[model samples]
Target: MCERTVRFSEINEIKEFVSAACRCKFDIDVVSGRIVIDAKSILGMLSLNWNEELRVVYDEQDPHFENVLQKYMTS
Candidate 1:
Protein backbone atom coordinates (compact mmCIF):
# COMPACT_ATOMS: atom_id res chain seq x y z
CA MET A 1 0.00 0.00 0.00
CA CYS A 2 0.93 3.66 -0.43
CA GLU A 3 0.11 6.68 1.70
CA ARG A 4 0.16 10.45 1.64
CA THR A 5 -0.93 13.42 3.73
CA VAL A 6 -3.57 15.74 2.36
CA ARG A 7 -5.38 18.79 3.65
CA PHE A 8 -8.90 19.78 2.68
CA SER A 9 -9.48 23.25 3.99
CA GLU A 10 -12.92 23.65 2.50
CA ILE A 11 -16.04 21.52 2.25
CA ASN A 12 -16.08 21.84 -1.52
CA GLU A 13 -12.56 20.51 -1.87
CA ILE A 14 -13.43 17.48 0.18
CA LYS A 15 -16.58 16.90 -1.85
CA GLU A 16 -14.71 17.15 -5.13
CA PHE A 17 -11.94 14.94 -3.91
CA VAL A 18 -14.39 12.31 -2.86
CA SER A 19 -16.34 12.62 -6.06
CA ALA A 20 -13.27 12.00 -8.19
CA ALA A 21 -12.03 9.02 -6.26
CA CYS A 22 -15.47 7.53 -5.94
CA ARG A 23 -15.56 7.19 -9.69
CA CYS A 24 -12.73 4.67 -9.50
CA LYS A 25 -13.05 1.03 -8.50
CA PHE A 26 -10.40 0.90 -5.80
CA ASP A 27 -11.09 1.61 -2.17
CA ILE A 28 -10.00 4.97 -0.79
CA ASP A 29 -9.70 5.72 2.87
CA VAL A 30 -9.21 9.03 4.68
CA VAL A 31 -7.74 8.89 8.11
CA SER A 32 -7.39 11.48 10.85
CA GLY A 33 -5.71 10.49 14.08
CA ARG A 34 -7.34 7.19 15.03
CA ILE A 35 -10.45 7.70 12.94
CA VAL A 36 -10.74 6.25 9.44
CA ILE A 37 -13.49 6.67 6.90
CA ASP A 38 -14.23 5.55 3.37
CA ALA A 39 -13.27 8.40 1.06
CA LYS A 40 -16.02 7.57 -1.36
CA SER A 41 -18.77 7.80 1.19
CA ILE A 42 -19.85 11.41 1.58
CA LEU A 43 -21.57 10.71 4.90
CA GLY A 44 -18.56 8.84 6.22
CA MET A 45 -16.20 11.63 5.22
CA LEU A 46 -18.47 14.37 6.59
CA SER A 47 -18.56 12.63 9.95
CA LEU A 48 -14.86 13.39 10.27
CA ASN A 49 -15.64 17.17 10.47
CA TRP A 50 -13.51 18.46 7.56
CA ASN A 51 -10.81 19.87 9.87
CA GLU A 52 -7.56 17.90 9.91
CA GLU A 53 -4.79 16.48 7.81
CA LEU A 54 -5.90 13.21 6.27
CA ARG A 55 -3.88 10.12 5.52
CA VAL A 56 -4.87 8.65 2.17
CA VAL A 57 -4.12 5.00 1.52
CA TYR A 58 -4.48 2.73 -1.47
CA ASP A 59 -3.13 -0.59 -2.65
CA GLU A 60 0.41 -0.25 -3.90
CA GLN A 61 0.01 -2.60 -6.84
CA ASP A 62 -2.84 -0.66 -8.36
CA PRO A 63 -1.34 1.79 -10.82
CA HIS A 64 -4.55 3.70 -11.22
CA PHE A 65 -4.87 4.02 -7.47
CA GLU A 66 -1.45 5.60 -7.26
CA ASN A 67 -2.30 8.01 -10.05
CA VAL A 68 -5.51 9.07 -8.34
CA LEU A 69 -3.67 9.53 -5.03
CA GLN A 70 -0.90 11.60 -6.58
CA LYS A 71 -3.43 14.34 -7.27
CA TYR A 72 -4.05 14.78 -3.55
CA MET A 73 -0.51 14.66 -2.25
CA THR A 74 1.30 17.81 -1.12
CA SER A 75 3.75 19.19 -3.63
Candidate 2:
Protein backbone atom coordinates (compact mmCIF):
# COMPACT_ATOMS: atom_id res chain seq x y z
CA MET A 1 0.00 0.00 0.00
CA CYS A 2 0.98 3.60 -0.61
CA GLU A 3 -0.33 6.84 0.87
CA ARG A 4 -0.19 10.55 0.05
CA THR A 5 -1.86 13.84 0.84
CA VAL A 6 -3.87 15.54 -1.88
CA ARG A 7 -5.96 18.65 -2.23
CA PHE A 8 -8.89 19.06 -4.60
CA SER A 9 -9.72 22.72 -4.09
CA GLU A 10 -12.19 23.09 -6.93
CA ILE A 11 -15.02 21.08 -8.42
CA ASN A 12 -13.45 21.14 -11.86
CA GLU A 13 -10.20 19.80 -10.52
CA ILE A 14 -11.99 16.91 -8.94
CA LYS A 15 -13.94 16.14 -12.10
CA GLU A 16 -10.90 16.30 -14.32
CA PHE A 17 -8.83 14.26 -11.92
CA VAL A 18 -11.44 11.56 -11.65
CA SER A 19 -12.03 11.44 -15.37
CA ALA A 20 -8.35 11.06 -16.06
CA ALA A 21 -8.07 8.40 -13.40
CA CYS A 22 -11.17 6.33 -14.22
CA ARG A 23 -9.31 4.15 -16.68
CA CYS A 24 -7.00 2.61 -14.08
CA LYS A 25 -8.24 -0.13 -11.77
CA PHE A 26 -7.28 1.04 -8.32
CA ASP A 27 -8.79 2.20 -5.08
CA ILE A 28 -9.06 5.92 -4.42
CA ASP A 29 -10.41 6.94 -1.06
CA VAL A 30 -11.17 10.42 0.22
CA VAL A 31 -10.81 10.68 3.96
CA SER A 32 -11.53 13.58 6.26
CA GLY A 33 -11.56 13.08 10.00
CA ARG A 34 -13.82 10.05 10.27
CA ILE A 35 -15.38 10.21 6.83
CA VAL A 36 -14.19 8.17 3.86
CA ILE A 37 -15.52 7.87 0.31
CA ASP A 38 -14.64 6.31 -3.00
CA ALA A 39 -12.54 8.78 -4.94
CA LYS A 40 -13.42 7.20 -8.26
CA SER A 41 -17.08 8.03 -7.84
CA ILE A 42 -17.79 11.71 -8.29
CA LEU A 43 -20.89 11.48 -6.12
CA GLY A 44 -18.99 9.65 -3.42
CA MET A 45 -16.21 12.24 -3.50
CA LEU A 46 -18.75 15.09 -3.27
CA SER A 47 -20.46 13.40 -0.35
CA LEU A 48 -17.39 14.16 1.73
CA ASN A 49 -18.34 17.87 1.53
CA TRP A 50 -15.08 18.97 -0.15
CA ASN A 51 -12.50 21.47 1.03
CA GLU A 52 -10.24 19.11 2.93
CA GLU A 53 -7.00 17.31 2.42
CA LEU A 54 -7.54 13.78 1.19
CA ARG A 55 -5.58 10.68 2.00
CA VAL A 56 -5.05 8.55 -1.09
CA VAL A 57 -4.32 4.85 -0.91
CA TYR A 58 -3.33 2.40 -3.62
CA ASP A 59 -1.85 -1.02 -4.00
CA GLU A 60 1.91 -0.79 -4.16
CA GLN A 61 2.10 -3.63 -6.63
CA ASP A 62 0.42 -1.76 -9.44
CA PRO A 63 2.86 -0.86 -12.19
CA HIS A 64 1.34 2.34 -13.51
CA PHE A 65 -0.41 3.27 -10.28
CA GLU A 66 2.44 5.40 -9.01
CA ASN A 67 2.53 7.41 -12.23
CA VAL A 68 -1.19 7.99 -12.13
CA LEU A 69 -1.07 8.88 -8.44
CA GLN A 70 1.62 11.49 -8.89
CA LYS A 71 -0.82 13.54 -10.98
CA TYR A 72 -3.07 14.20 -7.97
CA MET A 73 -1.14 13.54 -4.78
CA THR A 74 1.92 14.92 -3.08
CA SER A 75 4.40 13.43 -0.65
Candidate 3:
Protein backbone atom coordinates (compact mmCIF):
# COMPACT_ATOMS: atom_id res chain seq x y z
CA MET A 1 0.00 0.00 0.00
CA CYS A 2 0.98 3.62 -0.50
CA GLU A 3 -0.13 6.95 0.93
CA ARG A 4 0.10 10.62 0.14
CA THR A 5 -1.18 13.98 1.34
CA VAL A 6 -3.21 16.02 -1.14
CA ARG A 7 -5.21 19.21 -1.07
CA PHE A 8 -7.77 20.19 -3.69
CA SER A 9 -7.64 23.79 -4.76
CA GLU A 10 -10.81 23.63 -6.82
CA ILE A 11 -13.82 21.42 -7.43
CA ASN A 12 -12.54 20.52 -10.89
CA GLU A 13 -9.41 19.09 -9.34
CA ILE A 14 -11.58 16.78 -7.30
CA LYS A 15 -13.38 15.70 -10.45
CA GLU A 16 -10.13 15.00 -12.21
CA PHE A 17 -8.87 13.08 -9.19
CA VAL A 18 -11.97 10.96 -9.10
CA SER A 19 -11.76 10.34 -12.84
CA ALA A 20 -8.27 8.97 -12.42
CA ALA A 21 -9.33 6.88 -9.46
CA CYS A 22 -12.22 5.36 -11.43
CA ARG A 23 -9.78 4.02 -13.98
CA CYS A 24 -7.94 1.95 -11.42
CA LYS A 25 -9.08 -1.53 -10.41
CA PHE A 26 -7.32 -1.28 -7.06
CA ASP A 27 -9.01 0.00 -3.95
CA ILE A 28 -8.51 3.72 -3.21
CA ASP A 29 -9.76 5.77 -0.31
CA VAL A 30 -9.61 9.44 0.75
CA VAL A 31 -9.17 10.08 4.43
CA SER A 32 -10.19 13.27 6.23
CA GLY A 33 -10.30 13.35 9.98
CA ARG A 34 -12.10 10.12 10.88
CA ILE A 35 -13.91 9.83 7.57
CA VAL A 36 -12.64 7.59 4.85
CA ILE A 37 -14.39 7.95 1.50
CA ASP A 38 -14.21 6.00 -1.71
CA ALA A 39 -12.01 7.99 -4.04
CA LYS A 40 -14.18 7.19 -7.04
CA SER A 41 -17.34 8.48 -5.40
CA ILE A 42 -17.74 12.12 -6.33
CA LEU A 43 -20.54 12.72 -3.87
CA GLY A 44 -18.54 11.30 -1.01
CA MET A 45 -15.58 13.46 -1.90
CA LEU A 46 -17.72 16.55 -2.24
CA SER A 47 -19.07 16.01 1.23
CA LEU A 48 -15.61 16.34 2.71
CA ASN A 49 -14.50 19.57 4.36
CA TRP A 50 -12.29 21.04 1.69
CA ASN A 51 -10.53 23.31 4.16
CA GLU A 52 -8.56 20.41 5.58
CA GLU A 53 -5.80 18.42 3.97
CA LEU A 54 -6.59 14.87 2.93
CA ARG A 55 -4.76 11.57 2.94
CA VAL A 56 -4.99 9.20 -0.01
CA VAL A 57 -4.56 5.50 0.61
CA TYR A 58 -4.35 2.86 -2.07
CA ASP A 59 -3.31 -0.76 -2.22
CA GLU A 60 -1.77 -0.72 -5.69
CA GLN A 61 -0.04 1.56 -8.13
CA ASP A 62 -0.99 2.93 -11.56
CA PRO A 63 1.24 5.34 -13.41
CA HIS A 64 -1.63 7.39 -14.76
CA PHE A 65 -3.16 7.76 -11.34
CA GLU A 66 0.20 8.63 -9.88
CA ASN A 67 0.46 11.53 -12.32
CA VAL A 68 -2.90 12.83 -11.26
CA LEU A 69 -1.95 12.50 -7.59
CA GLN A 70 1.19 14.50 -8.19
CA LYS A 71 -0.98 17.41 -9.29
CA TYR A 72 -2.59 17.71 -5.89
CA MET A 73 0.09 16.39 -3.57
CA THR A 74 0.89 18.69 -0.66
CA SER A 75 3.51 16.57 1.08
Candidate 4:
Protein backbone atom coordinates (compact mmCIF):
# COMPACT_ATOMS: atom_id res chain seq x y z
CA MET A 1 0.00 0.00 0.00
CA CYS A 2 0.99 3.58 -0.56
CA GLU A 3 -0.04 6.59 1.53
CA ARG A 4 0.24 10.33 1.19
CA THR A 5 -1.22 13.51 2.62
CA VAL A 6 -3.12 15.94 0.42
CA ARG A 7 -5.21 19.05 0.74
CA PHE A 8 -7.82 20.50 -1.58
CA SER A 9 -8.39 24.24 -1.68
CA GLU A 10 -11.26 24.22 -4.12
CA ILE A 11 -14.11 22.09 -5.39
CA ASN A 12 -12.52 21.67 -8.78
CA GLU A 13 -9.51 20.02 -7.21
CA ILE A 14 -11.73 17.44 -5.55
CA LYS A 15 -13.44 16.76 -8.83
CA GLU A 16 -10.11 16.36 -10.54
CA PHE A 17 -8.87 14.06 -7.80
CA VAL A 18 -11.95 11.87 -8.05
CA SER A 19 -11.61 11.81 -11.80
CA ALA A 20 -8.06 10.57 -11.54
CA ALA A 21 -9.04 7.96 -8.98
CA CYS A 22 -11.80 6.59 -11.20
CA ARG A 23 -9.25 5.74 -13.87
CA CYS A 24 -7.43 3.43 -11.51
CA LYS A 25 -8.21 -0.29 -11.33
CA PHE A 26 -7.23 -0.58 -7.68
CA ASP A 27 -8.89 0.63 -4.53
CA ILE A 28 -8.08 4.06 -3.18
CA ASP A 29 -9.22 5.52 0.11
CA VAL A 30 -9.22 9.05 1.48
CA VAL A 31 -8.98 9.27 5.23
CA SER A 32 -9.66 12.11 7.58
CA GLY A 33 -9.73 11.72 11.32
CA ARG A 34 -12.22 8.88 11.91
CA ILE A 35 -13.74 9.10 8.47
CA VAL A 36 -12.55 7.02 5.56
CA ILE A 37 -14.02 7.56 2.08
CA ASP A 38 -13.61 6.09 -1.36
CA ALA A 39 -11.46 8.24 -3.58
CA LYS A 40 -13.68 7.70 -6.57
CA SER A 41 -16.77 9.08 -4.85
CA ILE A 42 -17.11 12.80 -5.46
CA LEU A 43 -19.86 13.03 -2.85
CA GLY A 44 -17.68 11.26 -0.32
CA MET A 45 -14.85 13.69 -0.94
CA LEU A 46 -17.16 16.69 -0.71
CA SER A 47 -18.32 15.53 2.70
CA LEU A 48 -14.81 15.90 4.07
CA ASN A 49 -13.64 19.06 5.81
CA TRP A 50 -11.49 20.88 3.29
CA ASN A 51 -9.63 22.76 5.95
CA GLU A 52 -7.83 19.67 7.17
CA GLU A 53 -5.23 17.45 5.60
CA LEU A 54 -6.43 14.11 4.22
CA ARG A 55 -4.58 10.84 3.97
CA VAL A 56 -4.80 9.00 0.65
CA VAL A 57 -4.23 5.26 0.80
CA TYR A 58 -4.04 3.05 -2.22
CA ASP A 59 -3.21 -0.60 -2.88
CA GLU A 60 -1.21 -0.25 -6.07
CA GLN A 61 1.09 2.14 -7.88
CA ASP A 62 -0.10 3.97 -10.95
CA PRO A 63 2.03 6.76 -12.36
CA HIS A 64 -0.98 8.62 -13.67
CA PHE A 65 -2.70 8.69 -10.31
CA GLU A 66 0.54 9.52 -8.57
CA ASN A 67 0.96 12.49 -10.88
CA VAL A 68 -2.48 13.75 -10.00
CA LEU A 69 -1.73 13.34 -6.31
CA GLN A 70 1.34 15.49 -6.76
CA LYS A 71 -0.82 18.53 -7.33
CA TYR A 72 -2.38 18.28 -3.90
CA MET A 73 0.45 16.78 -1.90
CA THR A 74 1.21 18.46 1.39
CA SER A 75 4.54 18.86 3.13
Candidate 2 residue-wise lDDT at 1? 68
Candidate 2: tens digits of C-alpha lDDT, residues 1-75: 666777777888788666655766766666777887776788887777567677876563344555655666755
lDDT of each: 0.74, 0.68, 0.94, 0.95
Listed in order, each prediction's TM-score against the native is 0.76, 0.72, 0.96, 0.97
Where model 1 places Cα greater than 4 Å from the true spot, the runs are 60-72
Q: Which candidate gets the maximum lDDT versus the true structure?
A: 4
lDDT of 3 by residue, 1-75 (tens): 899999997999999999999999999999999999999999999999865799999999999999999989995
The 10-residue segment with the lowest total lDDT in model 2: 60-69
Model 4 reaches what TM-score against the true structure? Answer: 0.97
RMSD of each: 2.6, 2.5, 0.7, 0.6
Tens digit of lDDT per residue, candidate 4, span 16-50? Answer: 99999999999999999999999999999999996
Q: Name the lDDT of candidate 2.
A: 0.68
Off by over 4 Å in 3: none
Candidate 1 vs candidate 2: which has greater lDDT? 1
Please tell me which model should have the higher lDDT, number 2 or number 4.
4
TM-score, candidate 3, is: 0.96
lDDT of 1 by residue, 1-75 (tens): 767888676778777777777777778788888998998888888788566668988663455555655666775
List candidate 2 stretches off by more than 4 Å: 60-75
Q: Which ten residues in a row have the lowest lDDT in candidate 4?
A: 43-52
Q: List the residue pairs that clash in candidate 1.
A: none
If both were scored by TM-score, which would come out higher, candidate 1 or candidate 4?
4
